[model samples]
Target: MPLSREKIAATAIRLADAHGLDGLSLRKIAKELGVGPMRLYDYVTNRSELLDLMVDVVYARIADVGQHSEWRSTVLTIAQATREAALEHEWFADLLGGRPHLGPHALAVGEANAAALSEAPAVRGIDDLQRALGALNAFIIGAVRREVTERRTARSAGTDEAAFQASLGPYLTGMLKTGRYPTIARLVIDGAHLNAEETFNHNLALVLDGITSRPRT
Candidate 1:
């Protein structure tokens, strides 16, 4: 059968997951699909359009979270799902926010998030709902980008975070001795559990709290 846009996007997603965004290319995807590079043009005009399709495919995975009646829970669920998807496909972190996503699945996810937030009594108007949704999405994208960066750094260093920090212990100790960065030193010595999920949840709650605590005007 001739290749379809969905098939091309699926293959591109797999390539991105395995090789990261920097490794994705029309030629590479064509090679993986056993087709000439020109063949892909029939489905997607170019790499930019292909990326849009891939993003929609990823968004489709979380498009149903808006079905919940509780707005806060719906937002949290979608945020967590986005984080998990970013973890699975690190390339996704780079594409997000790079361009507008108007594909069906992307629109569906947006509609779900908007609908859930719109139902909240705390959300007073369209402006408030838009702000809340924007804040939630901004937080998720920023948090996931940092997480993906850290994970990539660890992978490059061939060690987990604790081990990676241990490797830097001597250097960090020397730097700390200067007492030039007291706050960072204090955090390094006194911070609680540095769990990614725990940290993500804590910060996510903080963002939600801000949204929910806002006085209705």
Candidate 2:
């Protein structure tokens, strides 16, 4: 009921979700909370701090992939959970990888991941662990960005995935007929049409495998 940092972040997130980050302002959050804009500064210093709080709130939603039987499974679970959270909070994808998240909740997620990987035989030291985590984070962030962008494109065009592809069919057909892009043509014609979830899982498994299979340094 009372104003709090969490409440402010939550309101900002909700506003961002409904509209977008471009127009998210402290004034909007204050009005949403039925308070004056200056009052919001008591909880959040500025837009940057507000963004940090929003990201932390989203990270808090990530399910704890606590202590799995194997490090790979732990990493996989965490990655999947992160992706799920980002998808739910679409603005999260845009903010992710933009800055270091040192908030309690964000640190907890990172700590849980580091602890699990540290116990693994493949993780020789801090460097290896950092590398592994970095790789996963990079992939997850990039993948989420791409997926959300596609979703936005479809929404803006008022078309579903299938229809969107159909709309591009004519241009693609002409490009493919040139015979200069044999490999790309083959991919467009034969690539597996995995849904977003399947596509993410499939690529994620490959990334995990690559990470674990690297020679111990």
Counted clashes in each candidate structure:
0, 0
Candidate topping lDDT: 1
Q: What TM-score would each prediction reach against the true structure?
A: 0.93, 0.93
Total clashes in model 1, counting residue pairs 3 or more apart in sequence or in different chains: 0
Tens-digit per-residue lDDT, 12-34, candidate 2: 99999898899799999999999
* Residue pairs in clash, model 1: none
User: How well does candidate 1 score on lDDT at residue 30?
Assistant: 95
Considering only N, C-alpha and C atoms within 3 Å, which residue pairs clash in candidate 2? none
User: What lDDT is reached at residue 17 by model 2?
Assistant: 88
lDDT of each: 0.86, 0.84
Instruction: Compose the digit string of candidate 1's lDDT tens values, residues 33-114.
Output: 8989998888899889989999988998877554666777887798888888888888989978777889998888888788
In model 1, which regions exceed 4 Å deviation?
none
